[model samples]
Target: MDLSAVTAALELKSYNKVADILDNLMLQVAADGVAFHNDWPYAIHLLSHFYVHDINSARFLWKTIPSSIKESKPEITAVWKIGQQLWLRNYGGVHEAIRGYEWSQELQGFISAFSELYTKEVFQLLVSAYSTISIEDAALFLGMSKDDATSYVLQQCWTVDSSSGMLTVKKQPVVTEQKLDPRKLQQLTEYVFHLEH
Candidate 1:
């Protein structure tokens, strides 16, 4: 299968589309009985899964990759280590794994985007689960220093207790009347269906 579509998606910085493109390409390659081991950059494909927080798919892809390739490419191993940390929900380990590796040019953008997406996800979780959190824990979750995390929370309108070094999460009001895009809804339905099976 031609990888031009995947390349185009990446060029457009459409991380979400890259995964779908690769998924289709993999399906087509399987149908043609072609060896997918060496033709494609599986590390980037795996990172695409992480960009969307699809840990199950990333794990499945890692398990399916040939042992020889896994042994030969340290980049693949590095990416998988990040996946493992994400799978375990070890937020601090995830940050450490991301920072510890020197990702290649091809993989760097995806890794950075994954980190940002993960931070946003963590922020949402904290907003819903905690009325107050320490600056240190928040920093770990956001993969930032205490000073940076404090600034970030404050930007979100969260209050800081200087004496306790705790941040008060300011939950934003839910917008009930917002319309959902049909295209996005359809894509979500398909994604959930794929996950269910």
Candidate 2:
């Protein structure tokens, strides 16, 4: 699978463009359309699942998953199980395995921010892509071009400090740097909150 596209989108966190690609891919396989599964909780669940160390955050995400969907999408259940297992991996301490070994509030905050900024449909498209994709294909996906769309995604995932690991985000648009305003920040905040609940 071509991951370049995925990676490129990741850098930018351009969900709409990413969603469009995922829509095309899902059509190929007949998987329950990614768009159908998109919602705030899924974003919260997935972002926290991938980036946060806390089990409860993931658990919260799982709980948010619709029972009907879980019943229908066994693959999703399977993937969630794998994610749970990884989250439970023994971070061996002197006494025993510590479940909280990977805990990071920073990670949690990041996810929370995403949840607020993006909607459920926005996230579903992403979740569908990640589960279905392989690194090779991800690169292939990135190789395709949508110039404006690609730029929008890449710019959001950028930062100078390596301390904050770069991941895709629902990027904010700015017509010009000088034009950025509080309203734009508020809009992004809204998108981030959409996933938090």
Candidate 3:
């Protein structure tokens, strides 16, 4: 998949929105006639990501994920089978499958059991911190325009007041006189760049 547009969409902080975009991308891949098998691994990886990261309905994917490829599967079973075939074809199946390409056996076992539950709870902590600090707001401790600050906030870089120091989205106390150092600025730039195109 060309992630350029999806990378830009990651700027949206709403995990629900990300899931929608992910589902749409999956649909696009299914619609395309070519290379379904090649793309299936990425599709499985994305499902794992959604199940591991997003708080909302993260458990839903786990429920839907087939354990040992049972019978009475959804049509989407084809997706997983294609992914498994591709995996085996490239790396060989089961115990012989390349350990590097596969999830750590322990981690995969844990995920197969409870990754959905774990991520939903973990995201609670992530959003809790986000409630207090935005990546955008962190950048402007030295001071930047409201528009720029808001862009960073929306991009999940910082959560500062849309009004610069005067106000924040949640009316929290503004951070006091601290200038961002070159090191912090570079890190923030890289973080936002990763989320954006």
The candidate that achieves the highest lDDT relative to the unseen native structure: 1
For model 2, residues 28-124, the per-residue Cα lDDT tens digits are 5346433544332243234434333345645765776678877874444643553554465411221021122332442344433433343233333
Candidate 1 local lDDT, 1-197, one digit each (tens): 68898878887889988888898899999999997787677998889998886888988998899999998898999989889998898988888899998999988887888888888888998999899999999998888999999999999999999999989999989878979999999999999999999
lDDT for each of the candidates?
A: 0.89, 0.41, 0.42
Off by over 4 Å in 1: 177-197
lDDT of 3 by residue, 1-197 (tens): 66444445444323234456656666787688544433333334333444344423433543544554334433234334423433343212211222223454323542333333432343333445545654333333313344654564455433455444432334335579988799999999999999997
> By the TM-score metric, which is better: model 2 or model 3?
2
All-Cα superposition RMSD per candidate: 11.9, 20.4, 20.3
Best-first order by lDDT: 1, 3, 2
The better-scoring model by lDDT among 2 and 3 is 3
lDDT of 2: 0.41
How well does each candidate superpose onto the true structure, as a TM-score? 0.85, 0.26, 0.25
* Best of the candidates, TM-score: 1
At residue 113, give the lDDT of candidate 2: 40
lDDT of 3 at 89: 34
